[model samples]
Target: NAGVTQTPKFRVLKTGQSMTLLCAQDMNHEYMYWYRQDPGMGLRLIHYSVGEGTTAKGEVPDGYNVSRLKKQNFLLGLESAAPSQTSVYFCASTEAGRAKNIQYFGAGTRLSVL
Candidate 1:
């Protein structure tokens, strides 16, 4: 089973273009998250979903929107992309309320906005 999966592993966009990143997990996790890594910023959470249909904004959610329609899938959207928003986006998941369960990460999607 794929622990976590992200589509479109790499993308390039002109400023103001729109795109969506897709994430999926096969581990039946209840918690899913989206994070972006950039120079000096380390990693910052952009959005999360605690369960199917429940979503919330995270530390750097300003330019992103997320939806979780099924337990195994989470979608992140950039309505209007910008150069500053370019980064390596990662998706992670783990069983909810189990502190001992470590999150599993997908191979990140590298996005470049010009």
Candidate 2:
């Protein structure tokens, strides 16, 4: 109810299975982001959208796809699950002109692929 929230707080998937992770914000922010955190690797941006109906690839977009069909929602989809894709995923959002570093984040989604 404060800023952002991600659905399916935890998930487990088998190799080759497909799933979608959803991020929803109540702040009505124009910029939204998706990131993955790995052991000792820090967080890496997977994808982002500047505004509704617009999306861009980030540093680690190879195994992921994203969409922002509505201003309040962003979706990340994995076509085929893999062990390498397992990580803690976070969703963030902020005002268009606000400092990118100052973002509101979801509680995070834990995913494991076996």
Evaluate residue 19 in candidate 2 and report its C-alpha lDDT on the 0 to 100 scale: 97
Q: Which lDDT tens digits does candidate 1 get at residues 15-94?
A: 99999999999999999999999999898999999999999989999989999999999999999999998899999999
Counting clashing residue pairs in each candidate, in order, gives 0, 0
Candidate 2 per-residue lDDT, tens place, 6-108, comes to 9989999999999999999998899999999999999999999999999999999988999999999999999999999999999999889736457889999
TM per candidate comes to 0.97, 0.95
lDDT of 2 at 84: 97
Worst 10 residues of 1 by lDDT: 94-103
lDDT of each: 0.95, 0.94
